[model samples]
Target: MPRSLRARKLENAVGLAVIVALAIASVLPLIHILYMVIVRGVEAIARIGLYRFLTEPPHPFDPQNPGGIGPALVGSLELSGLAIAVATLIALPASVLIAEFRGSRISRGTLLLALTLVEFPTILVGLTVYAVLVDHVVGGYNMLAGAVALTLVILPYMAVQASEALRGVPEGVREAAYSLGATRLKTVYALIAPAARRGILVGILIGLARAAGETAPLLFTVGGAYEGYHLCLYKVGGAVPLMIYQFIQMPYKPAQDLAWGAALVLMTIIVGVMLLARLLVKEVKIL
Candidate 1:
């Protein structure tokens, strides 16, 4: 027998209410975290003038002020920039090959490797880099090792995204290119790449953001030299995430405050990149 109209209406209303409640429940934690970070971070930045807070190095012992994180800021830029560059250089071509040769044994193995690496423990990656490069080649923790670890961490993510993006290009586009007698390499470079540029760029930005915010990889790779900037890639360096990890553990109040500020800065950079990527996706009509 069919249900009465009133009973059916009540059931529909209850279902809608449950779904709304679940949605709010899922979002509540994120809202609370943002509130806490913003309140505490703003207070810390307010105590130290914005310019000084940004420009000076940490001064844990000083009674007057806790210095800024200039060295850390610079190190983060260097490591993230280098890692993104290397990861992009490797991911783009590898993704193209995988997308173009999905049936080949080599492509299958490469895709499987990337998929596995995407889920691999990041701390283990740092340790592996330490055992292979830092302990023997670099002789100590250095920017190069840190960047390499970050590159490994982000490479799989880039490759996966790039492959999906390349594959997503309309089949008609590929067919059109081949119908013109264009070789595989020429078709990929001239037609497929341009069509998939938005996704590729978004993937790169996401990887860069991840690289900038990563702390575990730096723990075993970068020596976390906090006194000043180590400009050379071969030298020990400091980054915002590493400093935050170190600072939050210190017993000093100033160090704790500095950690909050650094967290805010790292959060801002990641959020900005995400927002930019979103904007790109909205503005561009990817084929």
Candidate 2:
């Protein structure tokens, strides 16, 4: 080979090697975390029995009794459900308005604010909600406060996704609706919104998945009730992430085990939701 050709080939090979190394380096930590959680969490669940582990609360100070994460699991579901409902209710209308009035100052301002908030620190949202709801209004931490905090954390994401989904509807569809004498509100609600339902549902699932795994937002708002299961919005509650955060720091074997199990469950939930969203996206593309 010519000398310059040889040098170019060597440089390309070196660049490829570097990219491979970076990719592996980034994926290694996630692999390690998944391995540890699976191994230890499975052992913990096996020791306690899966049924009991799913239906009981943790005994943090005890080393022999490996308790379940029932309370936290239920609380996570309730909080995610409530937060998603409220966020979707508010986001849908705002998203429609933005899509319909793309040139208006209000629409531009709302879209800009939502995009800006998509990357905001969630812990600050937690602190703000704690001060506003728990300190002044609710008088203490409760499920409602936690749900409100999560709603705030997930709202921007839901709004942005819904807006994009609405905009994805063909302009021809809007024109057709207008030519059919449909009112502006009717065209948006009856035609554009239904056409974009799948995308909106994907956003809701993604936001709910994000909310379900949030620990910092629930740290000061949910009150961490592990003694029993709670279903009321006005009551204190526990979440899988919150339990893992509290348990992993304790100086007990059982608590640590419980934390691993909780982490596994939470990871499964978040991953499942994301995969469902991916499937929906694929379906959309194939259509």
Candidate 3:
């Protein structure tokens, strides 16, 4: 090889090696976490039975107690579902408006605000929600309050991703729609939205996972409960993150074991969303 070509190839090889090394390093911690959770959690689930765990409330911090995380699981699901619904209502339209009206000042300002919101800390979000909805508006911490806080926490990231996805929709396709006498609304909803469905699906899953895993916002908005079945929007709610946090802090073997199980459940939920998204994408592609 010529000297220049040889030098370029060596540089490319070095860059590739560095990237591969970094990627492996990044994944190692995640793998370790998964390993630890599985090793400690699977036994608890097996001993307790999945159905029981999904239907019964937790027991006292006794190693011999057969407590389940049913309420916590339900709360987490309700909270995440509410956040997903509200966030989608706001984020999807906001994303399209930002992309469709990229030249307008309102669009520019809205997009900039969205990017800014993504950087806002979850803890701060919790505090704000607590002060407004919990302390003032509703007069106490409640499930709806937590759901609203989570929506605030997850909406920006989802909106930003959705906006990028809409932006990637081919301009030519939109122009063609316009030429065919389609209204702007039709082009945005029928054409651009469908074209960017996969990216929007990713945004939805990301928001759902983030909201489900968050403990701080729940701490402020929805205080934990014990041995009860309450999925009310206006009542204090149980959540897996709150359970795990409370359990891990106690100086008891049973609580610790329960924490591990709860962690596994939470991880499974987030992972399941990704798996579901993949299945959805596959179905859409097939159609």
Candidate 4:
């Protein structure tokens, strides 16, 4: 082989090694965290019994046992579902518009706006919801308010993710569609959206995962209940993150155990969603 070709190969090999090394370094902390949570939490849950730990309402500190976190589990699912639904409604349209008009001033502005909103603090989102819905519009803190707050928090994420997915569609595909006398809307719905569905789903799941784990936003909006489960959207709600936070702060051992268990459950949920995203990402290599 030529000396120049050998030199280029060596350079490429070095770059690949550096990338692999950095990737491993980045993943090390996450692996450590997952291991720690699983070890601590699994032990606690083993002693507690899986059924009671998952189904019953939390019990006050007892050296003998701590109760379940069913109410918080319900609230977290409901809030995250509602938030995903609402965010998807707004985000899909915005993303579609941006994809269609990639060079438009409005699209540029919208992209910038979404990027800005993604950086907005979760506390601020909660406060905004509290001010607008709790005190002013709805006259109370309810699941509705909590869901709305989460929607604001995840809207940008969905918008940007969907847009990137849409952008990944080959330009030639759009041109081909145009050649077939397809309208812009027809092209988007029939061709672009299908090609990007997996990516969009990934974003949706990620947004839901983040929203579910949010404690700060729920602090001001949900103000979780311990007495009983609240099912109505207009009623107060509790979430797993809030339950975990409250439990972990107690001076009681049982409560601490419950906290660990709850953390494990929450982490399991987020990790599950992430794994689903990874599956979709692998299946759809458009980007």
Candidate 5:
């Protein structure tokens, strides 16, 4: 081979080797963590009874006394669901508007502002929301406050992802729709939105996953409670992350084990969401 071609081949080999090594290094920790979580968590789940653990309050799982995490799971689902809904309601339209009107000064400013929001820390977002909604207005920590805080934390990221997805819609498609005499809104809704639906769905799924795993924002806004799982929105609810955090500091072995199980459950949930998102995207592409 010519000298230049030989040098190029060597460089490509080196790059491939580095990429493979880095991929393995990046995945090792996740693999180990998942392995440990599955082992320990499965043991706990089996001992406690998966149905019971999913439908009852956390209690000692000894022969004398058995308890489950039903309430915590319910609360987690409720809070996370609410947060995801609110965030998507705000972010999706904003993203579409921004993407469709990139040249407008207002849209440009709004995009910049959303970008800034993405960099804000979860703790600060929690504190700000708590102060505005809970302390100043509502006068107490509640589900609404927690949801608002989480929405703020997830919205900017979702918006940015959505904007990118919307922008990715082919210009040719838009022009064709316009040539067909479709209004801007109609074209966006009928063509661009459907074409980029997979990306938008993936972004929303990611946002949901982020909201589900958040703890710092929930700390101030959702304040944990051990009892009263069936309370109203104003009532405090215990979450798995907060529960794990609280339990990890205790002197009890059972609490420690429960914390590990909770961690495993949370990871399982986020991973499941991600897998579903991937499957959805794949299916959309296939169709």
Candidate 6:
């Protein structure tokens, strides 16, 4: 082989090695964190009984007086659910409009506004929600306020992603739909939306995952309480991330163990959503 060709081959091999090394370095921290959580959490889960641990409130892990995390789980679900619902309602239509009219001044303005919103610090959003809802409106910290704040934080990201997904639908398909005498609205709703359904779903799932793990925004809005399960949207409730934060501050080993378990569960949920989104995208491509 020519010396130049051999040199190029050597360079390619070195580049490949560097890429592999970087990838490993990036992944190792995540793996280490997961391992630590699992190892620590498993003992707590086993001792408390999985069902009891998941269903009860935070209590000192005593065989006689074991308390589970059932209430926190429910509260997390409700808060996250409310946030996701609000974000979806706000994002879907906005995304559709932006995607369909990308070149218009309105679309341009909306895009810029969304970018601005997304870039705003989460603490700022939390403080704003606290001031407006807790001080000005509702008079105290509540789940509704927290949900609203989370929705605001997540909405811009979801909308921007949804718009990008809708734009990914081929122009040819849109033109053909128009040629078939479909109204512009009909073309968008029936044709473009269905075509990009996977992408939209992925965007929503990603938004949900992001919203679920947010701690700073929830801190000011949803004042963390250790009370047992309550469904009142006006009542403050504990969330996994908040609980983890609270637990880590305690000097007790049990609280720390429980924190690890909650962290693991949260991580699992986010990863599950991501995997489902990836599967949906893959399935859509296959079809």
lDDT of 4 by residue, 67-119 (tens): 77888888888899889999999999999988889899999999999888888
Model 3 steric clash total: 0
RMSD of 6: 3.5
What is the RMSD of candidate 5?
4.0
- For 208-252, candidate 6 gives per-residue lDDT tens digits of 887888888888887888667767778777788888898888877
Clashing pairs in 3: none
Point out where model 4 deviates above 4 Å.
1-28, 282-287
Query: Predictions ranked by TM-score, top down?
Result: 2, 1, 6, 3, 4, 5
User: Of the candidates numbered 1 and 4, which has the greater lDDT value?
Assistant: 1
Model 1 lDDT at residue 53: 81
TM-scores for all candidates: the values are 0.92, 0.94, 0.88, 0.87, 0.86, 0.89
- For model 1, how does the per-residue alpha-carbon lDDT over 1-287 read when each residue is reduced to its tens digit? 99999999999999999999999999999889888888888888888878888878888656477887888999999999999999999999989878989889988888999989988889999999999889999798889999999999999989988888898898899899899999988999899989999889998988988999999999999988888879798889999999999989989988889888888888889889989999878642211
> In model 1, where do residues sit more than 4 Å from their true spots?
1-12, 282-287
Q: What's the lDDT for residue 156 in model 3?
A: 88
* Residue-level lDDT tens digits of model 2 in 73-131: 98998999889999999999988877888999999999999988888889999999999
User: In candidate 2, which residue pairs get closer than 3 Å at backbone N, Cα or C atoms, i.e. clash?
Assistant: none
TM-score-better candidate, 3 vs 4: 3
Error of 3 at 56 (Å): 1.0
Steric clash pairs (candidate 5): 57-68
lDDT, candidates in the order shown: 0.89, 0.89, 0.86, 0.86, 0.81, 0.83
Q: Score residue 47 of candidate 5 by CA lDDT.
A: 71
